[model samples]
Target chain A: MAQRTVLFVLFDQVQSLDVTGPVEVFAGAERHTPGTYRIGTASLDGAPVRTSSGLTVVPDRSLADVPDPDTLVVPGGQGTRSPDPRLTDWLRAHGPHVRRLVSVCTGAALLAGAGLLDGRRATTHWAYCDRLAREYPAVDVDPDPIYVRDGHVATSAGVTSGIDLALALVEEDLGRDTALTIARHLVVFLRRPGNQAQFSAQLAAQTARREPLRELQRWITEHPGADLGVETLAARAGLSPRHFARAFRAETGTTPGRYVDRIRLEHARRLLEDTGDGVEQVSRASGYGTPEGMRRAFVKALGTSPAEYRRRFRPAPAH
Target chain B: MAQRTVLFVLFDQVQSLDVTGPVEVFAGAERHTPGTYRIGTASLDGAPVRTSSGLTVVPDRSLADVPDPDTLVVPGGQGTRSPDPRLTDWLRAHGPHVRRLVSVCTGAALLAGAGLLDGRRATTHWAYCDRLAREYPAVDVDPDPIYVRDGHVATSAGVTSGIDLALALVEEDLGRDTALTIARHLVVFLRRPGNQAQFSAQLAAQTARREPLRELQRWITEHPGADLGVETLAARAGLSPRHFARAFRAETGTTPGRYVDRIRLEHARRLLEDTGDGVEQVSRASGYGTPEGMRRAFVKALGTSPAEYRRRFRPAPAH
Candidate 1:
């Protein structure tokens, strides 16, 4: 019976999908159960703002003209790349006062700038995860899940994941059946759990600058199923293990073990997508000693099991 | 570069997501590969239109003022429930002239009204599939796919399926790698393959108005694996098999066999979602005879396999 008002903060160059995907979801919920949500959109000033996609949106009110709604949604975009300090200040002042605070994509950057996500588990667009972590040391950035809910604050990865998070919020507020009905009408999953690891734009390791290390990189990629311990890799590179480890990290921006893990993960993903091999076979071939090991790695880094990951990422039979 | 112009037709009470989702995808593609597309939105008179969720969108041009774009997109919402005759007339005049024509959600209704979809396989929002078929009997309505592409014309089901369709369109325009990059950035699937059957808003059967048949409905749901032939069910209902079959259709708005199929499918879906049973056991319990039969049903209706459907719809383990 409470918490009915939902407000979306709009801005210049905002990602249109981030704004509309979740807005339509809440609107659909309102249509399904009238009086469930009174939705509105606001911009920093009262003027119309052009979305990143070039669509112009006229807001219901300016942030200064509006009162804090029960739920506040902040959407991200290229605009977040150089956000106006006034906007982040506004978020800082009002974010904690709302019953629920949510961000989509690089909107988390704005939230992080406002310091509202301090000491909270959060996520942003996959490509920006490292930058978000580096820039905001107080926020724990988890890139796995499509969305993360830490107490009253929630942040969704990338753009469309906002729809998933909104559906969850509706499920919490109105109930699961209502959310499911809305999701069915929208033709999206009630949730994508986390995100697919196959689209790991952020995970590709940098090529080593040194020729020997670069050759080592190629060898590691070629033999993902081989023993990739530091000692083995160092011997293969003809360097002492300690020096090889530091040099690899310096050149690749990641440690030898982590680089090997990513190489094995990508190799196995390709096999799953391009081959008909079973999970067990793919695991052994990708250097995962057992299927359980692969499963754990998948769930830890991608919030999905290997089998489910293949099902989602593999092209749908060319139908 | 040969076909870069994409124009979206907008109207009052248009679903903002329908317009924005695809627009964002094309815009993302353009961002990734500059000069890829020149996109615009237009209404009949070039007036600003309010979205179904009350967001105001200012169109870039008027329909009459615009030239025939390479791609034409029509988005649907409450306004399509009683479309302006001029809009349909305009669509009828220009629909065939475009290099590619597309519709999202109930926008297919406008295309059908214009006779543009006549004799072509198309789909719309799931809830309106029956009405679309009944009203435009010439259009081959396939409800199974999230989006159906027939040559240069494409139609999508429901609201968010527009995003999936747009991703497909981008993939067709650019390369798979580019589309995948955009999809990763957006956090949406490159494709949802059609839709999830668990969200079968249109598949739910009408409750029989007759008490005898209503009782039969309950029985069928309670025991999906039971022998549900007309003779067996009729005998239990104290009526002759032939008479009961006729009465069932009149009361339930579907044939006995169809009703039983829905029951078994629903039962199987629930088992897949709620239980830990394997595919083989679930097939038998749902009266599917074999795992292959159940798989066939799932693929035909949901465009997903039983195992994949379970992964998609089940309540994911709490994070």
Candidate 2:
């Protein structure tokens, strides 16, 4: 049998990984299972589309010339931010022909725009779930899935989840060994499963909060470097320290102290990962009074020291 | 400071997610701190490069015309499989000028090909780690990292790891709040720093062994539908059941019965995830005689029932 072809459509400011991550899985699969899949790409017009980063991507086919695609993948970017009626029309027109219609991240918005998700259970990037639900009332949006598959329609959460969706499809088409090989190749578990909640339960607990406390949460987020305290935050929310503490637990699903610790820990992690800052500096910048404090947080939250965490998590610098 | 300019180099067979994932994180930052970043892409020859999925991407500039970028991101693809010497040369010549050099997935191989990984700690797509270590003696390859940053060189493991890397970078360049916003927009945690261990200590023990049982293990992996038992496996290994059980524990860090059950459960999981077979059918395919038995195993190992597991883990069908 001829290899099934998966065609990807790209555009200006499009999220690049939405396409590449899945492409990597498919490309890697050839090593394990010879000649099982073929992948390609295209654009709305024949012109090169600049990525959000100003990288121009030329399409393999124009909208007018796309061949019969076994699977059609559409990735989201700033280009999809404002609904393009023509693009929506094109997707709607092509919706029934493709074996599967897949979108990554906010590409779900584009799918929604096309009316393909109007009456089906679907999900997009989580931040946009409310907007998607608001904009497309006909669609039943699932905010939790990494990717949702309803018959032939599939949509993935955020940028990276596309890889999970793709690997799962590969497993479906091939078999477990082949999929495991690809996962090993990618160095990821075979599939996280869309049903596995996208966000951690703890994170959701923190984010699911009501105001005053919500305002305080925003303040902590906005001022990650500040030495935050319960009293100060409580004052900002116009609640007493004890009342605020109780309210915070009720509203955010965690204590004020733990929430603050989480924010600070997250801040320190960002510095350790992206910057060349020493542990001391990162610690201070994340509201920790000392490197030791930050180290303790790392041990508590991640079960690794800050230095070891940096060694494992930091991206290698170009020589 | 003026907004940092980022140039993503595009090419034929480029992984779509590699380009788009980073693009989304970087672009999403503009929503919180607008006008902080400018991102673009270019091809070596400024011609349209076909992505692995046959999507042709038009680039922003030819290699000759691109601005000296603040950050240079090279994504992995089959194009990097046997890298172009010219491309490697271009990277080597320009690598020094860029503030940071980053690679997603197998794109690290290109950096290694360019000699950028010399004497530096690095990582790539896990599947290619052996080849990377074998081929680049100067590079200290760490396969366990989701992403690694040594000096200004950064490399990520596999597809979605790129998003994690990008988020880290954004947090460094911008701030934690901004990075978190982007992460929230994408609906992913700010960092999943401790997610690198692919197998447990028990699985690692199995991987360390090299004997006739190793081949048997491989065979078991290849044929999950088989019903070979301790007796059958012992006969194949030319041992008595008692001796084989002891040796299996000594060599593989697991009891034979437990190992077989684990393998069976793993196979059953894949079937449940990839196929439409009912729980009973999946159980049978994975050598389990009954659905009830499989459910108990599934729940024990994975914390989800087979039916629920399928609903959650099943791959997106090709639309």
Candidate 3:
């Protein structure tokens, strides 16, 4: 079979992994199945592009000289703070010809800025998801999944998620077996199913900023199996449930129910990581009434199950 | 609190991720806990070093001018093929003063070449494991876990596994909660609690190269649930059990029992990844007589359980 050319666009301050992670995936796939992909790196002026981490990348061709690619990869970094018109203009002009379009980390912002994702459901780095949605209101920003694909365009969240996106692309191009081989070679998870929320549990926990609410939040985290309903929490804080819920949302930017869910999930994760407890034990210990309830919460909050969570995070003994 | 200095040594043709993955982990840790780590990059000549992927990295300082680091990191790449004496000499001379000595991927080769890994039980990228063991017989190359730490000297396998090593380092320096938070932010597995053998199942399957033996190997993979004892396999191959076992080992570099174990493990992994079957069902289907038997196999081989494996690698529903 003829190789599909995967052209990676480089720019000043681009995240090194945003480019290299996907590149390595494709390169690894090629090693597993020869003639699978032809990888290339390109820049605007054929000059060395300095990455955010002080690394410089030499492109295979300038945007003007490079041929139309089967796949186009745009990586994100601090460089996304200032979108280059030349690059965005080029993407707008050439994006349609490309069979697959991808953005890693905050690169989705560039695609949004280029008007390619005006009505597309896309994502970016978790830290920048809110800004991307705010700046490009036309783009349907869903800041959850490691990567999202609407039609031929795909956008991944954060730095490492780029590898997940690339692995998915490899699975799509080759078969599951081939993709698994490449993933094994890379020594990454065969596939990190679900969205990117697992990475944001900490961010969610720190939302409550008020003094009483902050104290309550700490208590809830420390005692996950406790009755953490709005009424109980409000009573603990010496306020009415209705007033406490409203104030909590106003201060934390999230509802009381959502806050509890996040805290419960965080506690559940800690239990799963530190212990070898069964799902039922973990669910009850982490505040859920039943294993089924906790399973639902895991799926809804982290897009995985309690049993699965323990499997992925449980610490192994030192060899 | 004073931050510890983490010095990453860069060289020409270094694997980009081998440097970036760990660097990002420390950087993320810094964001989570300010004054945690001060990151620095250094090179032998102080000139910009070109990475294997055609990227160039600028070092913060030359080795000659840089002060002794609290933690020293060495990343492997094609550069390891030709050891630079200056870098190895520096490692030998100053390695003891560094609080922690670390290597990522084939960087173990560099460390071993410097005689620092002498008699230390270490590991490297799986593909290079045998060669690393052969080249430096003095070093105890295990070639399994994502990372290994003998005293303050740490080493990791492959490129992305560097992140796992760095996370472990962070967990050691900070606490589990902080490391878990950093992992969540990075959207990586809080800790991928298994060895590299999980990733090398396919590699294990392809060891036999001769015709009839290779054909028999394929048959074993196809019938993983079958009785794969040496007696049955020898009968199938029209040879005495004793002769068959010896020939199989000589031809494939592994005993029949070990080969059968690998094939069964691979089959189990595939079933875990592709289906939602219960552990008992998967065990039976994958040739194990009981769930406990399979569980022991999983724990022994991958340092994880069958249920956990299924949770991690199960296919996501199509978007």
Candidate 4:
């Protein structure tokens, strides 16, 4: 197999994780399997770039000096909201050389700005998915995916999700065994796809702001355990129960009750994944009346109960 | 409460994930309670240290420049086998200022060599656990722990276990709610403690290496589905069935039949975590006579059945 080279682009205020996570996974792979892949970082300009953490990185190449890349990776950060026009244009110029054009976190915005993501199914950090869709009307924004790959372009959600996408790329370029080895070395399960739900407080907030049931939805997110009747919800939204239900489905793509349940479930999942809270505490905090209630909701929506989900999704603790 | 500062000591060939994974969880606590903690990185010398991935990281300070740190974090690498004398001296000198010293993976080796882990319970990367015990007889090595916090010093099993230790530290310093918030931000559950077994391949390999049992163990790992009766196993090892059973226990610290079952179950677990292969296939591949047999084994050992184990352990799929 030809040795694949990755040209990782770095810049000022870059999110350290967005670049490093994938770099670690791939680097670890190379460490274990010597001479299989070669990766290097480049800056648009030759100077050192300071990341958000204030750590400076000196890239091996300036964009002007970079080798033609087999894979081009663009990592996102707080700076993505107002990216350099020169950098955007550079991305546009360089997009076609790579077999895969991948973006991590809000880096999708840069790609979108460069027109690389136009007409492509893509994702960014969940917090900015809507903005990406709104700003680039041609881009098919999928907020739910951990990462997405369409044709030669790929995009991932948030900082750490890039690791997932990179692992997949490694698996595709090499094989499953290589990917699994890397994942084990990194101590992560292989990455989940973009179709997985991007459930969060922010996503719930977005769902609550749409038409016909905005008031009811807002009330539900705030008071998840409330037993508001359909009639009461409709009256709060100033529509007949029957009409409100139809419009709610049209606008939010889910029933009012089911939508409420989803918000609650999201909260519950967050608690489970993030806390040592027992099933009962998480259930109550998430507006489930009891542990049993939370379990049923989790089983219904995520195809796994809360305890099982926690076991699977819990982040590794740091010392 | 006095704000605690964690200084992660970086060196050439340092494991990137070992440092980054824990730092992420520790830093994330800021989301819940801003200004409560400070995180920084340091090196023995001020120059950038090349991580095991060949990527260079610029530390916040050199040992000479670092303040009196509340916590000192040392992560392991291939370099641990032959550490610089300067780095070891620095660790020895500053070991007194550090209220809590943490070591991840083979970082335990450095601590042990410094005499910091002497007479304390500690662990290193599973592959090196025996070596750690052999070299440092004064240290009580808990090979099964993801991490162990004994007195003021803490050590964790390789790589990802650092995350677990970091979360525990957060919980200790900031309280459960704050730690939970950080875990949520990082999308992980609170720490599961040292009691939870490290789920990796090294343990299986370690278990499969005893005399008289080694050949059968290799066979089991190589052919997970074949049913080998006690008589067959004894014959294969050139011993009478009764004598083989007694010798296997003496040699391996486990009964022969149980050892075989463990190998099969461990293989099933790897399959469950690494593949989308269903329970039946995993069972067949892992040398369980049937899916039901595999399920029973999973239930007995892991407290979860095969399908449920997969749901809880499988890495999320990459898109």
Best by TM-score: 1
Better of 1 and 4 by TM-score: 1
Each candidate's TM vs. the true structure?
0.92, 0.62, 0.84, 0.84
Query: For model 3, what is the error of residue A110's alpha carbon versus the real structure, in angstroms, after optimal superposition?
Result: 2.1
Candidate 4: deviation at residue A98, Å?
Answer: 0.9
Write one digit per residue (lDDT tens) for candidate 2, span A48-148.
Answer: 67666555556667777878688888888678888557778889899778998888888988888888887799887766777788889999998776788
Residue-level lDDT of model 4, residues A261-315, one tens digit each, is: 7778777877776779888888887878889988877766555567667765565
Steric clashes per prediction: 2, 66, 2, 20
lDDT leaderboard ranking: 1, 3, 4, 2
Candidate 1 positional error at A85, Å: 1.3
State the TM-score for model 3.
0.84
Model 2 reaches an interface RMSD of: 6.6
Candidate 4: which docking quality band? Answer: acceptable
Candidate 1 vs candidate 3: the lDDT winner is: 1
| Residues B47-161, model 4: lDDT tens digits | 8888877767788778889887898999998878899988898899898678999999899999988888878888877678888998999989977777788889988886867
* lDDT of candidate 1 at residue A191, scale 0 to 100: 57
lDDT minimum window of 10 residues, candidate 1 chain B: B193-202
Give the root-mean-square deviation of each candidate in angstroms.
Answer: 3.0, 10.3, 4.2, 4.4
Per-residue lDDT of candidate 3, residues B234-265 (tens digit): 99988999998888999988888888887788
Which predicted model would earn the best lDDT?
A: 1
Clash pairs, model 3 backbone: A145-A195, A199-B184
- What is the TM-score of candidate 2? 0.62
Interface quality of candidate 2 as DockQ: 0.19
Return the lDDT, model 2, position B128. Answer: 75
